[model samples]
Target: MAGDSVRDDELAWLDATEQAELVRGGELTPSELAEAAIERIERTNGALNAVVTPLFEKAVAQAASAQLPAGPFRGVPMLLKDMVCHSAGDPLHGGMRVLRDHGWTEPEDSHLAARFRAAGFVFCGKTNMPELATSVTTEPLAHGATRNPWDPSRSPGGSSGGSAAAVAAGMTPVAHGNDMAGSIRVPASCCGLVGLKPTRARTSLGPGHGEYWGPVAHEHVLTRSVRDSAAVLDTIRGMAPGDPYTAPPPSRPYREEIGLDPGALRVGLRTAVPGAAGQPHQDCVAAVDEAARLLESLGHHVEPSAAAVLDSPAILEGFSAVFGTIVAWEVDRWSQRIGRRIDLGELEPMNARTAEVGRSAPATQWLSGLHTWQQWAREAAALWEQELDVLVTPTLATPPWQLGELAPTALAPAELAAAVGEKIAFTVPFNITGQPAISLPLHRNPDGLPIGVQFVAAYGREDVLIRLAAQLEQAAPWSMARPPVSA
Candidate 1:
C-alpha cells in the first residue's frame, strides 16, 4: 500500500480517530502521518503563525520509534498550546518575551503531556498564546499574532488561539487548549472548532503546580469533531498523585457518551449578555436562537432561562481581584523559577497593571474574592438542581474581531479589560462554577466567519455535554466547512 501517497488535504481533514485508524490498519505509518502534518504546518503556518515552535525532527523521530505508545490515538499529530502543559526539553514560554529571551525549557513533561504521549499523539510543535494566557486575543509581544484561517485580518481567540487556528485551518486534527476565562471555548467559537472546558480538575495540573488561577482554569483540546473531544478526554481525564483536588469520575468513558441517548433535556437559552444592558452582536444572538431551535427539533425542550446570579455585581469584582492576584503570582513564580525577577517594564502594560493590583491588594481582599466566588457558584449551581439540564448561549459576545482590536500594547488597561470582559461574558461564569461547557460551530455569518453556540452542563457533567454535542454535530455537520486559508 502506498501510505506516503495520501494527499495533504485529505490528511488535513482526517480527525485523530481516522488518522489513528490508518496507522492501525497499516495504510499509513506514524512517520507518514507526522510528515504529512509537518508539511501542512510548514505550508500553512506562514500565514497563520499558529505553530510557533515546530518540532519536526522530534515528531518524525517519535513517530518512527518502535517504543511509541500504542494507545488510542497512536500516530496522530497534535499541537500543545504554549501555556500550562509543558513537554520535557521543549521551550515553554507561556507567551512571555522575558522567558523567550531567557531560553527556558521544561525539565519534564506535565502530567497532561505525559498522557498525550501515552495516548500515542505525536507532538508537532507548541502553539502561540497571549502573555501568561491572560488576554482573549493572541497577540503577544513574545510571538506576535496568530491569525484566523477564515479571515487573516481577524483573531482566532486566545490563550489557545494558535491551537484553535491550527485545528480550524486543518493543520492538525486536534490541539491542546486550557481555559481560565474562555480561553478554550472562545477560540473554538472564533475558529469554528469544538472546544470543551471539562469540569475543573477533570485533568490534573501536577508535578509543577496544583491549581492554576485559583481553580478557574481547566484543560482540554479543540477539535473538529465531538467524538474527538470525547475520545481525547477519555485519554487524559484522571487524577495524579498529590493533586489538590479532582473532578468526579465519569460513570463510563467519555467516548461512550458520544452516541448514547442524552434523553430529552430541558435546555435554557439566554441570548442577552448577563450584567450588560445591551444584547450580543446580532450574529451571536442569531446563533443561539438557531441552536435553540435545533435543540427543540432534536426533541429537547428549550426555554428562555439562565442563572440569575450571573448578573450579580460580585461576579466581576471577585473575578478581577482573583485574576489580578494570579497575575502577580505568575510574575513572581516565573521570576523564582528562572532565578531572576521580571521587571514591570519587561511585562505587558495590562499585566503590569494587574500585577500592581495584585501586589497592593490586602490578603483579606483575595480571601473575600474567593468567598464571593464560592457563594456565587453555589447559587449558580442551584439552577441545574432545580430547573435545567443545559444552558445555551453565544460562546462569544460577537464574532471574531480584527487583530490588534484588543492588543494590550495598544489599549489602556481599563480599555483592554472592558473589551475582554465582553468576549468572556457568557463563558467565564462556568469556569467559576467548575462546570463542563462546550462551544460548537453551529452557525456562520454572512461574512463567512463561524459563530459558535455554547451548551453548559452541571459540574462534572461532560458526559451530558458530549451526548448533546455529538447529536448536534450529526444534525449540522461542520466537517465540510473549510476556511479560506487552510491546509
Candidate 2:
C-alpha cells in the first residue's frame, strides 16, 4: 500500500467511495482528508453560502482521535442538513432566525445522525436550508440564499439546496437530505447530482420520531455517483426498535445491485404534470424525451402514461390540507418545545398562512384531508401495480430558476404556495405514496445548466430504481461533468 499523502487540490473531485479507498489503501490519513475538506469549505463556502455553521475544529478533533470507527465510509467527510439530523450540543437552527438567536441546540444525536457516525462519516458542518425547510429555494432571512454553483444568479433548489450545492461544488462527496415534498430530488435536479428518496421507513427517523411530515418524508443522501448512493444505503438502512414503519428487507445489499443488469422492464413516461402547474418548459420536457429514448435503447419498453390523480381537484386539495395541517402542528410543536409563541417576524408569510389555515380549519376538515390522501395513495399506487414497473418524468416543470423567482419572503401566502406547487408537481406525488424515487442528471439545457430525469419505483422497490440508475449512468455517463464554481 502506498503511504503517500494526496494533495488537497487533487482531492476536490473524489467521491466518498474513492476517498475511503484512498484512506484504506494508505494513500491518505483521515486527518488529512478532513483538513482538505475544511480547506475546500473555507475556499468555496463564501461563494455559495451552502454551509450555515462550520464545525471545522470539531471535525478535525474527531478525525484525529483514535476512537473513530472503521465502517464503510471510513474517513469520508460529510455535511448534515440543518433540519432533524441533529448532533448533541450542535447548533441545529433549521434556517430560522429565532432558533439561531435563542441558541437552540439538540440534546443528543438523532437516530440518523448516529447512523452517519457509525458509517464512519466525519461531520464537518451543517448546511443551509429554507426557514423551517418550508420553501423550495434555500433563501432565508436567517442565512441568505445558497447560490447555485453552476450559476450563482440561479437557485440550487431547496430545502436541501445547501447540501446539493455543497456536494456538486466538491465541498463534500455526500451530504444528508430528507424529502418531505420534493426537497431531496428538487435540489438534486437543480444542482446536477444524484439523489434518492428511499421507501418510507427504509431508514430510521428515530431518536427523534417514527416519521417526519407523516409518510411524505424520507431521509437519504445526495451523491455524484450512483454507486456511492447504493453503498451509503447499504451502510445505513435499518429499522429502529420503536420506528412506526418498517420496509420489507432487501434480497441483498443495495451496493451489490449496482452494475448488475436490470432485466427488460416496463417503463411509463410522462412529460408534464396536469392542472394549474401543467405548463412544463420545452427544455424540461426535452430532458424527459431524451431519457425515454435512452431507456428504449437499453431495451426497456417505454410508453406514455399519465398519473391521473395528479389532475384531480380532490387530490390537490387534499395535498394542501395535509401540508397545511402538518406545517401548523410542527410550528406549534417547535415553538412550544422552546416555550415561546410562534413569532410572525421569525416565520415567512407563506408558512404562516399555512399554519393559520391548519389551525382555523375544522377538525373534520383535517381528518377528511388525511383520509382523502390515503385514498389518493391507493389510487396512485394502483397505477404502478396494474401497469408500470417504473415511471420516468422530468424532475421539474422548469430548470433551476433565478434566485428570487419563487421568493418565500416576498410572495403572498396563496401565491407562494402555488409557486412551490408548480415547481414540485411531479416529485411530490411519489412522496405521497411512499415510493422510492431517484433524480439523475441526464441532460443539460442550451445554456448548459443541468436538468434531471426522475425515475420512480413502486413502494419498497428501491432495488429496482438503484439497478436501473446504475445501468442508465453507465450507458450515458455524466460523471466527468463539473459546475463552474466547483472546488
Per-model TM values vs. the true structure: 0.99, 0.97
* Top candidate by lDDT: 1
Residue pairs clashing, model 1: none
User: What Cα-based lDDT does every candidate model obtain?
Assistant: 0.92, 0.88
Residue 173 lDDT (model 1): 97
lDDT, model 1, position 168: 95
Best by TM-score: 1
Candidate 2, residues 33-128, lDDT tens digits: the string is: 898899899999999999999999989988888988898888889999999889878998888888888889889998888989988899999999
How does model 1 fare in lDDT?
A: 0.92
- CA shift at 75, candidate 1, in angstroms? 0.8
